[model samples]
Target: MSTAVDDDLWSAVGDPTRRRMIDRLLADGTGTATSLSEQIPVTRQAIAKHLAVLDRAGLVHGATAGRERRYRVDEAQLARAVAQLNAVGSAWDSRLDRIKRIAETIQRTGGGSTAEPDTEHRNEKE
Candidate 1:
């Protein structure tokens, strides 16, 4: 079963803008919507919205820093995301290896086509 966090996590990071926001946050250690807007091309409101999504995904946490909130990336959640990506990559690699072996076996046996011949059509032609 999939959890809400998985969906939110992927949704948050799927957008280029949010990804850029994360990168900037990582580089700067912590940031506010106003500060991020200055570094990114978007408006402060947009940055805030992206930050909300990231916060929902558990990718970042925000603390009230006077008037504006200061956001920092959550290392543990980021590590979880990395591990999920690695697991998916390993599964694909295993599947590709299986496919390669099957192809090699077919080639060695000179079985160029897997489809069977149409006997009825061949009889009609003959």
Candidate 2:
């Protein structure tokens, strides 16, 4: 995923209320408006609103169970989100590894300016 879109996905999931709602869905196989409302502090109306957001984000899918509607997590979308996070994490890990390698090389070489900032780009032949 592009970083901007990936970031937005995480931003939507970043809300504490939404996180709790996801936890509730994960723990329970499926939930209805009334069922979710009972577990959360919000009212049934508020739960519906949250559910709408989750649906738009592709985090949850709701089905009509007779007169009531039931909602469940969209595992595929969750997996996509997980994979995106893992990719970003892997990239950062590589960057850190390169930084450590540079430090080790400097220490082994015994450079005079141990912690000096990069000055090679500066014009030195005055």
Candidate 3:
């Protein structure tokens, strides 16, 4: 079962601003909300709000350092996101492989009718 954590992560990353903040943190290793705001067009308070969503999503975590809290990307959460994407890719690959095999069989037999004949490859090498 998928948890709310997944939803939050997806929602947080679904926005361009939040994604930019994440990218900034990744490129700079770690940064405060104010620092991220300076790199982007949003205000510091807006950046903080985006960071809050990221924090809830477990994509990022912040800690106190002197007078400000520093935010950093959580690699574990990123790994989970990558794994989910890879899973979808694997499923699509399997489906395409099945379609290819079926296509080859139909081409060889030449008697099948109306069975997804569109799988014929235009760019395939013989």
TM-score of each: 0.82, 0.69, 0.68
**Order of candidate numbers by TM-score, starting with the best:** 1, 2, 3
**Compared with the true structure, what per-residue lDDT tens digits does model 1 show for residues 1-126?**
222236667778889999999999999999999999999999999999999999999999999999999999998888777777677788889999999999999999998866889999999999
**How many clashes show up per model?**
0, 0, 0
- Stretches of model 2 off by over 4 angstroms after superposition: 1-5, 66-68, 112-126
Model 2 C-alpha lDDT per residue in residues 1-126, reported as the tens digit of each score: 433336656765877877788889989988998999999999999899888888888898999999888999998887777887788888999999999999899889985474766577454633
Over the stretch 1-126, how does candidate 3's per-residue lDDT look in tens digits? 232236666788889999898889999999998899889999999999999999998999999999889999998887777676667688889999999999999899985776654445733633
Give the higher-TM-score candidate: 1 or 2. 1
- State the lDDT at 27 in candidate 2: 94
RMSD of 1: 5.7
Q: List the residue pairs that clash in candidate 1.
A: none
- Which stretches in model 3 have alpha-carbon errors above 4 Å? 1-5, 96-126
User: Where does candidate 1 stray beyond 4 Å?
Assistant: 1-5, 114-126
